[model samples]
Every structure is written in structure tokens, then in C-alpha cells.
Target: MATAAVDRVEMSEAEWEARQELAACYRVFAMLGWSEMIYNHITLKIPGEDGAFLINPFGLHFSEVTASSLVKIDIDGNKLDDSPYPVNRAGFVQHALFHRHLPDAHCIMHTHTTAGMAVSSLEGGLRATNFYACNFAGQIAYHDFEGVTVRDEEGARLLEHLGNKRVMLLKNHGILVMGKTLPEAFIKHWSLQRACEIQIATMSMGTPIEVTPDVVAVHQRDLHMAQVPGGAGAADFAAMVRLVDKIDTGWRA
Candidate 1:
């Protein structure tokens, strides 16, 4: 397999590690059917680099994203690197807003998978009727879709809806999640996707059985308890990275 060598001449070890993991995430998303051709995004800030983040180049499929190929940009979306690929303007702006305002939001992922989109389009976004949904209980938030999220004003409103929640369903648009680390953000997206898939499947059979709030509370507690050791999904994300290596390691470039 022909792969481009990542030029690490000027890259810090921490930044290189961040790129490798973030690029692996793109392949993981591809494997799980969570990609949208060349759209959607998953971004992680370069560790030890203030306000500089890494994003997938605009034209490649998720599977084609590579560690060295990810573009580095500043807070206002200016390209800080010499990559030939351009960044997705709207995606950068939208993701940059959260990364800029929230110090804890080091990684962000947005997706438009079929099931997630179906749930987002529903009038009753993300019903608390499944195990995965229970993880969010009262932690998920929703923003009314105002279009494609290109307008500058939409960023503020989106953040307002997101508030303190790590997950948000972009009504009629898609799902977005942010985390203090890449692993945490990836797992949240995985959980949300599972929850959305289950909700859609359950609804088709009949009226779904909505669990009690107490059940959700207990479920959430049990789930959060798992995070204490692995920094909110490190274990899960590490497993996925290994899977990506087995399938295709071109992302490591």
C-alpha cells in the first residue's frame, strides 16, 4: 500500500500522537458507517499547541484521512500548515466556536449517519427508551435546525443550546459531541449512534417502552463509574484504534 510519509521534522511528539489518533478515528468512523462521503468532521486540538487544532482535509473520504494529511488551523480557521487541501469553511467555523469558547472541549465530532439523522429529524428527538440513551438521561441537549449552520449567528445559538451538555442533537441536521479528550468524544458519538439506532429500530415495531427516570439515573451512574479509570472512554477508543490498525494502517501516515 502506498502511503505518504508524515513529515515530522517540525512536529512535536505530542502533536504527532494526536494526529495519529485523530486520523485513526476517521477510519474508525468509516468502518462503522458513520461517514458522509467528504462531509461531516472530527477535530482534535494538537496537544501542547495553544489554540491550534487538526481537522481532516476537505476533499477526502474518511478512510483516506491520514495523520500527516490532517490540516492544522488556528482559532479563526486560518491554515497554519502548508497542506494543499483546503478546510471546510462551515465545519471549521462551527467546530471552532465550541473549541474556542469551551476550554474543556478539546475534541469535537459531528456526523450525519442515517439513524442519527432520522432521530434528529424526529419531533421528539432522542427518546429515553434505550440503554444507550440512558447514558445521557438529562445530559443531552437539542438545537432547532435553522438550516445548514453556515451563518455566524447560528454558532452562538448552537452554543447556547449545547450549554454544559457534551452531546447535542442538531435538530433536522445531525449530532454533535465534544469532550475534554478524543477518546471521550469518540465514545459519546458511538453511544449516541447506538442510542439513535436502537430508538429507530424500536419505534418501528410499535410504541417503545419508555423507561423510568430512576432507571436512567442508575444506568447513567453505572456508566459514569466506568469512566473514572479510563478518562471517559479511553479503553473503548483504544480498542477501536487497534481495530483500525488491523483493517488498514494507511491512516498512520
Candidate 2:
């Protein structure tokens, strides 16, 4: 396994820990098949640094990402570090908008998974047919596709569409989820993907039974109430990190 180089510039313990956590997140994405080559992005804000964040180097695959290799930048996408790689401009555009505007959104993840893209193309988007889907009943948003999100102006429209919501389905594009922490973001994406997968599978079997709106509301409320501090998502993410370490420790490097 390739070892990560030590950070040449000094970083606080918290900052270093954030880098390691973000790197682990990228590795977990690769292991779970959530990464779309090097296309999509998962970005995290640097702890204690206003408007500063860490993102994967543009040319590296998620599996190849390492703590020391992550690029640090401000909200405007200007590199704050001396990394040889450039930031993916489109990724910076989208993630920067959210990180800048949303105080609670410390981590933002975007995915172009098969199921996510499939559901995004659907007319109704995610259906409230299963428990997984029900969990996002009123908490999801949808942004109309305006082609690739490379234009800086599109960030305003994206944020407008995502108003106060944690999950968003980019119509005819893919999925984006934001959270206060990396584990929260990862768990949200996993749940959203599962919901899409379940929706597609059920639809393939001809007409599917839809859950009643009242029941869906109750399920949503129950989920909100059951969410404890550092819930199952934290445990699941830690376990996945362990699995990744067991297979290849390069991510930590």
C-alpha cells in the first residue's frame, strides 16, 4: 500500500483529523461503488476554518485519494495549498455554493450512480413506496437540470431549488446530499441510493403499491425522532472504514 506523505504545511490536530476522515470517506465511496470514476465529488469543510474545505484532487480516482493528497481551498475554489493537481471546477462550483450558503452543511456529497441517475430521469422522482423512500417524504428537493454545473450562475439556482432541504435530486442529472458531518452525508447518500434502487426494482414488477401519505408522514416523523447523536450511521461508517483498512491501508496514507 502506498503511504501518504506527511502534510508539509503545519495543520492542527483537528484539521489533520478532518483530512483523514474525508480521505476515509472517499475510500469508502470507492469500496461501495458510489464513486463515478473521478467525476463526482465528496467535499468537507475544514474544521475551525471559515470558508475553507478539502476536496479530492481532480485527476485521482476515489480509491487513490489520500489524506495528504487532498487539496485545500477557499469557497471561491482558489487553491490554498501547493498541490500539483487542480480542483474539479464543476465540483467546486456546486460544493462551494452549498458550503458558503448553508451553515449546517459541513459535508457535501454528489453521486452519479446508476440508480441515482435513473431516478433523477423519472417524472415523479423518488416514490414513497417503501420505508426507505418514506423516510425522505417531505425532506427532499429537486433542481431542474441546466446541463453540467460548470457555470457559476447555476449555483444560485441550485441553492434556490435546494432551499432548507438535506437531499436533492438533480433532475435528469444525479443526487446531492449535504450534512453537518461526513458520516451524516454518507448515510444520507446510502439511504437515498437504497430508496432509488428499491423504487426501480418495485416498478420493474409492474404496478407497485404506494404507501399512504399519512403513513409516510408518520414514518418520517418516527425517523426524525429516532435519530440520536452519532446514530447507526456513525457506527456503519466506522465499520466500513475498518473494512477498508483491512483490505488496503493506502487511504489513510
Candidate 3:
């Protein structure tokens, strides 16, 4: 667990809050069984810094992440902090590409959960066969598989496939979600993960029925209207935060 904290650097109050919230998010993922050893990552842009964001230290489990332990880096994968932990450049290549191009992508989540990877490996992608899937009627995007190594040029293609959509299924890989805030990203990932799990269960049975396209569209419209107006994902995310805090508040340190 990168025990090289010689001297924790000073950060602005805004970055400190972002760090705390993002650290909480990592713990939340751990609590929900979304972590895969030391793999996968969730990154958030520093509040008042340009070209700088927070990512998990490469060697630590999500459960061990703390606000003062996250590694800060720029869009090019260069460390902006004094933490001795390394960043997994290969895993972060795509994230850097999207963060550089998408202004509203303040928080980016990448996960290879069992169900998420299973659904992504399927040819049909995420089937709109459940309630959570309906939320992304036409919102979800898909990128064809291109092996493990992602080049800078391919990153451009990835961006092209992502377009303006916030959710994407990386075929044969995993799920990627971006949001303007950490809470928004967390909520999207939860919905996507749940939809994948339900799809797996539904398919285990007989032929599963899918909601019609027209009905799906109506469902999305009404769902948007039903939202409580103010915060995008604040309520659900706050609830999860409370849950995680009850388990352990060490992440806030």
C-alpha cells in the first residue's frame, strides 16, 4: 500500500473536499463489492485546478484509500503530487483522453465487475430488458473491442465513439461512466451494474422479453420528469455515503 508518505502536500480547501468525497466514493465501491483487487479506477477533477485530477494510488485496495492518500495527476498522466505511489498509465490512458476532451466529465468511473464484464462480452451489449436499463434508453454508447493496448490515436477513436454520451460499454472490456460530479458518476455506475446483473438473471431463465422502443422512450421521458429537480444524483449518493461512513470513516482522513 504505497507507504511512502514522506510529507503530505498542502491543498486548497476545494481540492481537499473533492479528495474527501472521492475517497468516500472509493470506500463505497469497496463496500458494494465493485473493486477488483487493485485494478479499475474512479477519477475526479480537482475543484480549482486545471489539468489536474485525483486517482487512486496504483497499489492500494479501494478499501484502503483515504482522502490524503490519493494520487494527483494531470491529463498526460504526470503526477502532480508528492505521494510515492505510482499511477497505472496503461489503465489511465483512456481516462486521460476523455478527461482532456470532455469538459463536463469531472468524475470518471471504470469497473470490471463480474456482471459488467460479462454483459460487455456479449454481442448484444446491454439489453434494455429491465427497469434500470430503461433509464439509458438511447443514452448508452458502445465501443468495439480493440485488444488491451490503447494507443493515443485509438484514444481519439474512443472519444469519437463516446461522442456526447456519458455512459459507454467497452466491448470485451468493461463499463465506463463519466459525470459532472462524483455523485452523478456513482449513481450511473450503480444503475448500469444493476442492469447488467438483472440481464444476467433474466437470460438465465427462458427467452426474456424486452420493453418496446416506444415504451422505452416514454419511460425515459417520465423518469426525467420525475427527478426531484435540484441535484442530479445527490440523494442516492448521499445515502450510499452514509452507509459507507457507518462502516468506516477512515476514508475521510
Off by over 4 Å in 2: 1-9, 224-229
Candidate 3's residue-wise lDDT over 85-129, tens digit each? Answer: 899875678788888889999999999899999999998888889
Across 7-110, the per-residue lDDT of candidate 2 in tens digits comes to 55678777788989999999999999988877899999988899999999988899999998899899988988877788898899999989988999999999
* Model 3 ranges off by over 4 Å: 1-9, 228-230
Clashing pairs in 3: none
Give candidate 2's error at residue 67 in angstroms: 0.6
Looking at model 3, residue 221 earns an lDDT score of 77
Across residues 77-119, which tens digit of lDDT does each residue of candidate 1 receive? Answer: 8988778888898799899999899999999999999988999
Report how far off residue 252 is in candidate 3 (Å). Answer: 0.8
Each prediction's TM-score against the native? 0.95, 0.95, 0.95
Candidate 3 shows a clash count of: 0
Distance from true position, residue 210, model 3, in Å? 1.2
Scored by TM-score, the top model is 1
**Once model 1 is optimally superposed onto the true structure by TM-score, how far is the C-alpha of residue 250 displaced, in angstroms?**
1.3
